[model samples]
Target: MRRAPRIRLLLWHASAAIPVLGAAAAFYGPALERAGGAWPAPLDDVYIHFGFARAAALGHPFSWIPGNGYSSGGTSLTYPLALAPGYLLGFRGAWLGLFAALLACAALLDLCRSLRRLLEPRGGPGAASSRWVAWVAPLFVVAVPLLDWSWFSGMEVALLGAVLGRALVAVRRAELAPPARRPAEQLRAGLLAALLVATRPEAIALSAPLAVAVAHAAGSLGAAASLARASLPTALLLGAHAAANRAFTGEWSAAGAVRKLLLSNPYPTPLEKAVEVIKNLAALRVQALESALGGPWLSLVLPLLGAVAALDRRSRRVAVPLLLGAYGALLLVALNATARYQNLRYAAPSLVMLLVAAALGAHALARRGRLAAGVAAALAVAALAAPSAGFARQIDHFARASANIAGQHVEVARRLAARAPRPRRVLLGDAGAIPYLSGIPAIDGLGLGGYRGMPFARASVHGVPAVVELIERLDPAERPDVFALYPSWWGGLADVFGRRVDAVKIEDNVMCAADEKVIYEADWSALAPPGERRAGVIDEVDIADLMDERAHGYAFPSPRAGWVIGAVLPGGGDGAPRFDAGRLIPEGREQSFTVGAAAAFARGPAVLALRTDGGGPIALGVAALRDAGGEARVEVPERPAGRWSEIRVPLRDVAPGDRIRIRSLLGTFRSFHVWLLRP
Candidate 1:
């Protein structure tokens, strides 16, 4: 029946859409939901972007909240625009998901368009010949290592690819069109080129080949002028972005110029600096190639094939832009390797050129039949295997680990919020969920202009000095209630806060400590009597004495006479200790040494004491022992002075019946000075 044929067509269309839908689901489903689920940490830029999007939704464009900070240099306005519709539809996750979906759709469409051109016969070639060539052409384009790289992150590469494809089509159409209509075609070509530029600044390099191809195909200067006019919109957009940068940062260029200036040292000659820049760019190109292909071999081989294919008469015109764009990318990579942070996404604008070249090559090779099939199969396997391996490895590590770490930060923020009074300012070094979940303003320690300045100003009011003095005034009572200092900045804080008063262990060896002078009521009352007490009535002495009495011995021990050691073994597979002697030893080398037992100390009254010199400053406290009588370990009551050279204890402090043992916690100490003390 006629109905059967229409039903078949509908089914075919639905089947074609299945891949796009599946890809969208894969990219958006779990990934977008988990995007901002984690708190502040390294590589948490996704969350930062999500937070910015949320802020934008709340009528606070360009304003960053506590946990999330402002975009420092270049902001991605495209992401917000892409997400705005989904956000309005009441599916905030759809903001990121929809963008990813659109990108996938664009990529698929671009591939189909490129394939169609490669399949079109030249010089009256038959349909069968064109089909044979086009089948492999699609495979070659899809199998490129660069395309695989785009899958890791949802980026503008797909959109750029689609635009380039459209431009290439327009260029081809203009060449075959009538002279009177050529001008209109050129204008359309230019407009497409301009759109590509608007989407990505890097597309300017691609535009060069487009302009030349359009002009050559149009066959007249007047037609080229009309085409140039069509490109004005893209020029205006670029000009506006530059102007905005100048207005905000007082620089004509983007913030990247400032970064370049700061990162580059003053050279003796311009030539020398230029040479250095070239070297750096080359290194980045090498890295980009390796990232795309999984190794150097594929990087060299695929691009060579592309070049060869572009040289063919039917493909040479399209190949020109592809080659130029590829070279431009190499130049960009060599000059700014660090900018490859986006990996393939950064190299994506040029991908259309590369794909076009590959498709042409595939078409030319298909004339050789079996050879083309072999090459296509090999390229497909390589592309699929490499990306699959990379994705599997990444998922194995990031899927669970990222979630757990993010959850930990969320819990930490919650605890801090419950303990702190309402409306209290919390000064956190690494801004995480503390600002959002804790309902407190968060500040970044890196000093990039946010609420971070407020806490630093508050701390300075209490006579505390800070690195950046962004604010002028602060109330003493309004000082930072908590100081979340990461280990990296721990040493730096000594100069700012005078001393570290208390410490709490957090994830990744993160230590959240506070200054003794800046006391919190929650901390104070935890040590006070069970009955209610007025915070204002407690004088400095009452607080200080309570702190001193309750303070445990040194949280960690300092090394003096001996080094701390672990996991040492003798050559014969016997367990022993290894000592450090200010020199490097070959792996698996065996050595022995002894430490004197003259300076061990105890905190409470005991009849037995053991002496050893291996525990670093942190080991000064009581540590749990397996053979000891009690489950809890007692710490030294007094704080050590001058880096804790040795532990000293009176003979009577150790109990007679308790088994005493001493061992180094971290350094290399082969032997211990064992001794028992009696009253």
Candidate 2:
């Protein structure tokens, strides 16, 4: 009898595995066929994990590129670590995606089995419900096309789902256990919580409810003791992750969050930020409900339906946690701007949580009567099986998207890799596929890969000119040899600083940022001072170049507080730097520059010569060091509107260590260059 139950249980799992794996195979087959038998993943982001996994396998864990050092680009720290083993087993290149697919399929299978156990009741009129749930629940969760879509996308969504499923199982086990056994059950829940967070930080919401459910089952003392033990593992893991991120990236959060989150972007006011967040949250909630793959809108209330089972106190323990966790997961993705992008991959965890709660509701309704059972089964099937109605369309989309990546990013990378003398360093905006396939050191223009420093992240948010300023600050040797970027994305930068060496244009572009990408040989000669040094010019500062400003002891509080370097101003064919009211800060601005001793005691008293655009009048204030009370002021009147002109601020007895402060008194102004000249 025991063997028969075991065999029957094995049969149920096998049944779930067949459809799940078969669906994955179906997705992969079309993708491979579309890519001309090449190993291709549906998204460029997939190769990011592959690159990190390759580095980990080669003993450089957390490094985006082997020699690039530690990077926080991998969103799921544990995921690439998990895939690293496959790299050791020779699953390199496109085959690594296959390995990921197989792993995700197994996770889905485990999720199905867990859901079956969670929905199966022990006795009463509900006993018959268990028999049907054994087959229906597993089939339902596995059959959702979006789940299949996410799993085969070669991302961490499935692993997160599996961890959540196991956490639910552990929660249920703790709820039923006697006080003595609760400790061990809680330990399992705690460790799973750690794993859950490691898979995706937002999963902490799901993990928190498990602890609450466990505590609700036992009394205060048992709950406190169990939770104390449970909290240890998660706390330590989080501490270690924080330490590593702080050490390498100077941040407590991953680089992905820094680059992608709307909260991380520059905002003018706190109120505006709050408004945007609320707006995004509302939009995401609607999108999540409407998405066929996210399941029926009915899921929003299914947990309440499941509350009917709470008449049994033990059942109430199960119902409360599932309900909270589902909504918590929803809130997690709803707050993120990128969650709905990339075919809704980030929202998959929330969708899975909703379905799990809905399954509970169906089980509860099935126990009431035959009519209720039939109706409940229909709802369950609609929640799960209805998603498959679009599976064929999803498969077609996967194939075409994979082909798109392979033809564009992969092709460009391979060509570069096969060069006679491989380029020393390549810069890329789309940092995923190219870096992984080419095996070249890359400077990710977007800072998603190995590009170091918060300056890059901050500059990227401000736009091309700010990015150019950051690049100007880099040492010459650190600059890239070639740039691979979409003309549509970085046209100004490329046109100003690079010579086009080659280009690639694709037909019917869908997944790429643009239809055409150009490769350029870096040519920064134009960045040098335009003409010969003028006579009597003792010292000068290229005000637009951030590095030059820094070298001349330029000081301003605005940029740090959200003022941005303006767009590249084409002043009579010159790339002049200026400041504008970017996202938040006001147009009015002020800056201070130190006049060197060489210029202070030149042939005679110095004159501050400023090459500027006559936007408005500016006030110039001069004071010598240690002579604060004695200061001089000069007013500069506006000139022609569209052209560059020179303005002079005459000074007397301006000895060494004197300072010059320029303030825009009326409207915005642009200073191309500032010079300390002898009269």
Candidate 3:
């Protein structure tokens, strides 16, 4: 093959720039117009980055709320800091988003140039002119709907792609460089490797190929020495991030990973978590191929090209390990249940890595005979055409999603910001826009922002009561004054402890969790101990108050094990909420609890006054109430089920430390409040 004419680097970049920026403009123009000339981001998460950026610019780098301590909620520590410059320049609202768009555009353009460098031929006979690869590669990436969507979404996806793309190019250049200059090029690749990991931790798997190339760079020192020299920057940056998190939150990883990843959730057993991981891994692979790809069958092109590339002698080492590392990245993401969410953003990096490898495979085939070249051309055309066909629809979805976020989250935040005596604290299930736009301190109900991660994450799994227990323990000054939540997201917690103040509803909602998000004024007066006291009452156990239950040594089987908190309000009217928030025992099952008092128990016999829903026969016993006696039992008759009733069991020598066991011997029932009284 004759040598192909070389184009100036500037002109090559312009060629890639025209298409990539044009596509980004195509998406943003309609999206901004749909959001009423406002730059509403495609997802709520974009505002999270903006919020952290503002904090960083204001001299509080990791603080989610100014004056608040550091929070490890954000997944990317560097992206936010990178955006801080925009905030420092007064890029509020839409301008901040525009700043991000420009940065993203530059990243994509750089990525295109890097990709071109990777595909160009290094002198060899019949190497088939790679001039076509330059124009075709950038065009193909631009034609991809998902990549273009992410480019303008104001997220870190574009930056991550560019970093990894440039890192690969640098590695390839170092590997083929003259021995005298190899070390310098290897160092450059290593620096990009550090940036790649800082942008997104999972990219560590994607960066494995770079690590190998760096360690094995020609004319380098020993593998360990070379690897260390290249990796020092990454170690220091990652260590600083971890140390900051440990100092503020007493945890090493970011709060987002802890709360969002499936492995971090509270599972009953390790076996159950293993089961979920396997299911997630299979589902992620299927979704990546069938749903994320422009066309379902286009998925076959990746593995086919990868196989051909792996079989080629010259590229085998890079191809085989790159393919395996990309797979490892995919599996690592499977540990996050949201691996396919938000247009599969979590899985996009791995998919893009595979695409880059496939591109190399295509380049390898083109260097072969006419038949192989023809095959690569056909597959490439088909792959590019499918994504191009879907660009129109993806752009429309992007516009609508942007509009949904603007009309709902942004509008609600504006209202909150306008309120007089501005809310001291706002509790939110969606933590991004509310705190940033409203300038209010936020308690992230999902534990992704200001809330302490592990406790909130574990409480989230156990249901509302567990969360309420944590909330009530907050310092009085830090308690939320207003709650902004999607009604469906918080299971009965809002209805139980809040009075509805307003609701923001939107149309054709495809991004926010629900069509309507309601605001509530926090109300806890109902949870206080009731005013009226029963005759001869010595100590009371308020079952409805989770904290009180904790103090009284409450224990029950799992929510799935027939025990759940239950409550009733007569006629469902606006009267006092009958508090009965503890174990709902099934028929023939027994439950037990301990009763403690602040003062010493009176030296006399006492009566156990139990408040419950009337069922059939009930047996109440004290576990070793008297040291010299066996368990004491009492039987009570059934009453109607609609109203609350009290049953008393006589006790002798029972102390605060003793346990009281209740058995619903006949019919399923609820145990609400218990009191120990002088008889």
Candidate 3 least-lDDT 10 residues: 566-575
Off by over 4 Å in 3: 1-7, 126-128, 177-191, 216-220, 224-247, 251-253, 267-283, 313-318, 369-371, 452-454, 527-679
List the candidates ranked by TM-score, beginning with the highest. Answer: 2, 3, 1
Top-lDDT structure, candidate number: 3
Error of 1 at 225 (Å): 0.9
Residue-level lDDT tens digits of model 3 in 1-679: 2333444666777788888878988999899888976785888899889988998999988766676567787777778998999988878865689889988988888778778887777768536643466667777567567666776798898888788788877777667778777778778877888888888888777566667756765454568866775677677778998887777665676777767777665434567777777887777777665455555677677667777777886565456656876788888888886765676667667766766777777877877867778888787776667556667878998999999888888888988998887899988874588788888888877666755433454345445565565575566666788999987878667887788999899999877888999989987654423345656677777554545665677665443343445555342123455545555666656666676766367556787777777567766544533545665666667767666677777776677677766666555556667788888
State the lDDT of candidate 1 residue by residue for 1-679, as single tens digits: 9999689546544543454445444433444355355322222333334444555666655444623333333234454444445445664431343444464575665655545664476654333443455434444444433453353244445556666777777766666668888777777777777766655556667676767766656565464474464455557767887776545433355433333331222212456557766766555556555555556665555565567566765566666777787667555534442454433345554555665665655555444456565674465345434433354433333333333334444455556666625536655543444454565664444322234213222222111122222211233443454554544443323333323433334343211222111212212111112222233211111101111112211111121222212111121112222211111112222211111122244333432232223333322222223224432332433333222122443332342223233333333322211223333
Clashes of 2: 0
Model 2 residue 186 lDDT?
A: 80
Give candidate 1's whole-model lDDT. 0.43
Tell me the RMSD of model 1 versus the true structure: 18.9
Cα lDDT of model 2 by residue, 1-679, tens digit:
7999899888887878777777878888888887866686878888988999999999998887887777877888889988999889989887888788878887888888788878766687757754676676666665556656777788898888788788888878876777778788888878887898889887777677767766766664466777766666778888998888777766777777776776776533556656666775665565554555444554334444455544445456666666666567667665565665676667667667766766677777787778888887777766665556668878887888888888888888888888767887887874578878888888777766756543455456556666665565556676788889987777557877788988877776666777677888886543433334567777877654544554567655353343444333334334454321122122355667776654445334677777766455656554544444455665767676655567787766455566666665544545557777777
Better of 1 and 2 by lDDT: 2
Candidate 1 to truth, TM: 0.55
